[model samples]
Target: MAKLTKKQKEAHAKIDKSKSYDLAAASSLVKEITNVKFDASVDIAIRLGVDPRKANQMVRGVVTLPHGTGKDVKVLALVTPDKEAEAKEAGADYVGLDEYLQKIKNGWTDVDVIITLPSVMGKLGPLGRILGPRGLMPNPKTGTVTMDVAKAVQEVKAGKIDFKVDKTGIVHAAIGKVSFDAEKIAENAKEILQTVIKLKPTTAKGTYLRSIHISSTMSPAVIVDVKTV
Candidate 1:
């Protein structure tokens, strides 16, 4: 194993591995432990009891963070010419259809979120291989594929994010940046956590939320008590 650097060691030393912290305490501690020069993203990892393999137990949904994700979300509006103006007016960074489709075909997915009209989805189907793995495929369930281009673009720019449970039953999402106040981080974390709780599947047995952890891009994970969440 690679030896930990002094900063990494110091970050690990600040937390007690045996104890789980409340959301507020974990949020504050994560900021304190992050030593990266740039503003690191604060992420929360939640392990749920549900099995992603089961259709009924699969958990996936969207939530708008109380404080917008500190990162500026670059949105691509893949819409017809008629909706181009609306998408642009809604603050989409890239607005177009065929030209952008060709760009993606040539492996240029430079944007964060892709919003497109329902009519445009058929054209996108052929490019699923390129977009699916990158989590860029706009799906109706997540409100990414819709007729209301402006609303979709605005929501994405305003901190709306979609998350799905991985095969291992863990849901990982970036809540905010380390530069944000602890309160903002805590609130963002709460927003996602509460949303996840509400999405608990009826088929899921036992504890829905198994374990929760909060950390920054480069910091050690801080265990968050499931009870306190």
Candidate 2:
């Protein structure tokens, strides 16, 4: 095994691996351990007791973090010429139709979120192999495919994020940056936790939320008490 650096060892020393912390305490501890120079992202990992393979047990939803994600979210709006101005005015980083579609075809998925109208979805069908894998494909359920291009772009810019349980039954997401106040980090974590609780699949048996953990981009994971969440 690789040796831990002095900073890494110090960070680990401050954490009690045997004890689970409340949301607030976990959030604060994560900030105390983050020693990266750049603003490291504060991430939350939730393990659910549902079988992701089962159709009825699928958990997916969107949540707008109360304090907003500290990172700048880049949004791409693929719409007709008529809606180009609307998307641009709403803070979309890239806007257009054919040219952008061709760019995507050539494996140019440099944007974070992709928003397009229902009419334009047909044109994107062939490019699913490129977009689907990158999580850039616009979907109606996630509000990424809609006629309201402006509203979608604005929401994404304001910290709206969509998440789904992975095959391993773990839902991972970045809540905010370590630079944010401990209270802000806790609030963001709570917002996502509450939202996840609300999305519990009816068919899921046993404990819905099995475990929860919070950590910074380069810090040790802090286990969060399921009861306090």
lDDT of 2 at 102: 94
Q: For model 2, what is the error of residue 141's alpha carbon versus the real structure, in angstroms, after optimal superposition?
A: 0.8
lDDT by candidate, in order shown: 0.95, 0.94
Candidate 1: the clashing residue pairs are none
Query: Backbone collision count in every prediction?
Result: 0, 0
* Candidate 2 worst ten-residue window by lDDT: 66-75
lDDT of 2 by residue, 1-229 (tens): 9899999999999999899999889999999998999999999999999999999999999999988899899898999999999999999999999999999889899999999999999999999999888888899999999999989998988889999999999999999998899999999999999999999988999999999999998789999999898
TM-score of 2: 0.99
RMSD of model 2 against the true structure = 0.7
Predicted model with the maximum lDDT = 1
